[model samples]
Target: MSIQRELIETLQLNLIKHKVILLFGARQTGKTTLLKKLLTSDDDVLWLNGDESDVRLMLQNQTSAGLRAFIGAKKTVIIDEAQRIEDIGLTIKLIHDNYPEIKIIATGSSAFELKNKTNEPLTGRKLEFKLFQFSTKELVNHHGLLNENRLLQHRMIFGYYPDIVNNLGDETELLKNLADSYLFKDILMLDGIKKPEKLIKLLQALAFQVGSQVSYNEIGTLVGLDSKTIEKYVDLLEQSFVIFKLNSFSRNLRNELKFSRKIYFYDNGIRNAVINNFSPLAIRQDTGMLWENYLVSERMKRNHYDKNYCNSFFWRTKAQQEVDYLEEKNGKLFAYEFKWNSKKNAKITKTFTSNYPEAEINIITPENYLDFVL
Candidate 1:
């Protein structure tokens, strides 16, 4: 069954106005599926896959006339894996500048390649959107709140990837294949990495350290690589959308842990796959970490879909006082503490409240997390 994506309407509206629309996400996140849904039978569409040698050659033509000749009279042009094509940014720029009548949609799984190629050339000519693993809102919208509540633990363990969400059998096997295949595809395909095993080792170290500050030096020691390599691999992981990093929040307090950052996986299933663990929450020692990661990732998806502008961070001081999530938006601070156990009391740090008396603090648990994320 196909679920409607939140970005479909926005994308349809953008197509009418923007010369080019770039949809970015990790592999197997249903970008192509969404694009197919957006296209109708009457629409004059030219679909091209950048992975095809001939398609890349046709699009790589630098001249506007060359691109125009290839596009012909197509009203809408869709390119899958656009980042794989050489000079794609310049090619898209040429198409938009010369053939303003043609609407373009480009999908890419690798931000490192696409952003570097597209940023400057298509600066004013493009609208960009990020598609994440299915969000809580999407699931609830399609399956109802009652079903969502029943499947919460399954989501936390197997994650909300489109394939895994739609399939009912062997979630652990599916996630393991996804982790080994698509999850590391971008990193393995990229150049300058002599030892790919180091990347896997780094990810394994990070999988265990979710919800906590990560030290590059410590990870390097665990992975048997140097700090510089660890940092590069971590950056690649973030760029590939396998994980995200949250820096500490500080307002110049000397005791604030400003330099450290926490790492969280984009999906819990991928995280568990990294460590080869899929035991139920009750039997797992890392349930708290899973809960924290799930809430943060869902919040991120909500913010993206809603187009909410905010800066996010984890707050902690040298004294070890902490808040799991901190969001700065509209000149105000909203702090959140994540609790898997509803019995736990939510408390703001004395240091945080004293320094920023205007900020608001709240607790996010399973009982009320939908309000915050959805």
Candidate 2:
């Protein structure tokens, strides 16, 4: 199944020779695959892999004339794993500034490394985009809504990573491999991680606490690391795209919980694999956790692809009244509650409604989830 990515059309329309296009995504999320689909012809494209020692050597410390000689008549240049190249920002800036007729596209799996390298040199000179796992809308477009709704159970367990989606029936093995090492490769390679085992333990601890506010101090004590170190590792994990942090939403309320945050894995399969549990919904105790994670992850993808900009968070008060997910856009509050069972009655608490009278309240159940996510 060679389904097209939703970003292809936007990327195609945004391509320009003067400013570079930077694509960032986790490894195996199909950055290269999307490039293959977008670049259809190789006639005038100069493809270089930064992972190659020779390629890195050739691009090291080059001047405008040097680059011109190297690139010779190529109209398009793509450097994959670009964060591996030292001073890639300067190199890209040179190409963008010197060659007005050459189009430049670079890809990296680590946002921290890539953004650190390019933020200054490429400021105001590049347009950036992030590609994530297959979204529900994309899947439905490829097949149909009925087929996708039928596969929801499997999706929550197996996730939507390109390879996992393409290779059905092998999700456990694939997710296990991903969770074991590939997801942490970049984080582990960076400095400041003295004990790697503690990092894994911390990730597992976070995995178990999905859909709830996380305390760095508690996780630190449980994992045998200090809170500062735990926070650093969590930030690194988020930048690597394995997980994300959602802060508590608070405004115009005296009892609102402030400065609290929850962490969630970007893909449910990775979260389950981290804890080594693949039980079905009937026998599982974490079905609600999985449902919340799936809904939030899909909504994030939809927001990014659709260019719907909003500030997202989970809302809770010191008194424990809570909303599962919240979004603030155009100065209006939108609160959501996620329930896997259609029979369960879920709604925003009156405390929340009274405090924010103009807010839009919604409950997302399995029967009506398509209206929310799609």
**Number of the top-ranking candidate, with lDDT as the measure:** 2
TM-scores of the candidates are 0.96, 0.97
Per-residue lDDT tens digits for candidate 2, residues 1-374, read 98879999999988943578999988888888898888878888899998899999888899999999999988899999898899999998998898878999999878888899999999999999999989999999999999999999999988899889989888899888876667556567755767888988988999899999999999999999989999988988888888999999988588999899988888998888888998888899999999999999999999999999999999999889999999999998999999898787777899999988999999999989998888
Candidate 1 off by > 4 Å: none
- Candidate 1 per-residue lDDT, tens place, 134-208, comes to 999998999899999899889899898999999878788889899989756666886556788888888899999
Question: Against the true structure, whose TM-score is highest?
Answer: 2
The alpha-carbon RMSD values of the candidates against the true structure, listed in the order shown, are: 1.6, 1.3
The global C-alpha lDDT for each of the candidates, from Candidate 1 onward, is: 0.89, 0.89
